[model samples]
Target: MIHEISAVAFRQNLGEMLNQVQYRHDSILIKKDGKPVAALIDARLFERIRRMPARFDALCHRIETAYAAVPEAEGLAEIDAAVAETRAGR
Candidate 1:
């Protein structure tokens, strides 16, 4: 479950919040001035989240290299067709 708490309340109960996240797999969203500012999540989930950018970069690089010889118009057309096909449930 996710808990939305203000910055002040989060600061005042940091330890309790940490325990909730550690033991119950609960996520805490911290807000400042009534707007969400940050979140506290389990360390393992955080690790996976941290790796996403690197993984995305690697995937982008691989696709770019594979498509380097394709013309821009053809590449765009292929992407459009693929998107349309998927959206059309095929």
Candidate 2:
């Protein structure tokens, strides 16, 4: 379960709080004046989210189609030119 702690308490007991987070892998919801202000989560959890695949390929395809409507180059020549320029540092 997630742990809730007041901002003041968190500031006063940071070391102990970090120890709890390290051992328990529990997220901390920091509150200010009885309202949630922020959260402290483990780094591994953030990495897991970063590695996960996108869930909306259909949405991405629709957006790509809409973007393509703007009408740019018709072939790979433009892309190849850009890549060559980048490789030459220019």
Candidate 3:
């Protein structure tokens, strides 16, 4: 679950919010001056994110290989069609 609270409210209930993060794994977005300033998340999730290396390069390599195997314009048209279908909620 995602929860949002003001910085002042979060400070006032810091202990309870920590418990919620630790036990319930709920993410918290803390806003200050009517804008998002910080987030509170479970430590385990943070560690997992820290441990993972970004895979954008691998994804780009796969896309390049796929495009190379097909007519580039056709592949791009297919991709555009798929994106349009997705955006149209099909």
Better of 1 and 2 by lDDT: 1
Top candidate (TM-score): 1
For 27-90, candidate 3 gives per-residue lDDT tens digits of: 9999999899999999999988776655666788888986787887888899999999999995
Q: Assess every candidate by TM-score.
A: 0.85, 0.55, 0.69
Question: CA lDDT of 43 in candidate 1?
Answer: 98
- Poorest lDDT segment (10 consecutive residues) of candidate 1: 81-90
Please identify which of the two predictions, 2 or 3, would achieve the higher TM-score against the true structure: 3
Model 1's lDDT to the true fold? 0.98
Q: How would you order the candidates by TM-score, starting with the best?
A: 1, 3, 2
List per-prediction Cα lDDT, in the order shown. 0.98, 0.82, 0.91
lDDT of 2 at 76: 56
RMSD (Cα, Å) for all candidates, in order, is 1.8, 13.3, 2.9
Report residue 38 deviation for candidate 3 (angstroms). 1.4
| Better-scoring candidate (lDDT), 1 or 3 | 1
The global Cα lDDT (0 to 1) of model 2 is: 0.82
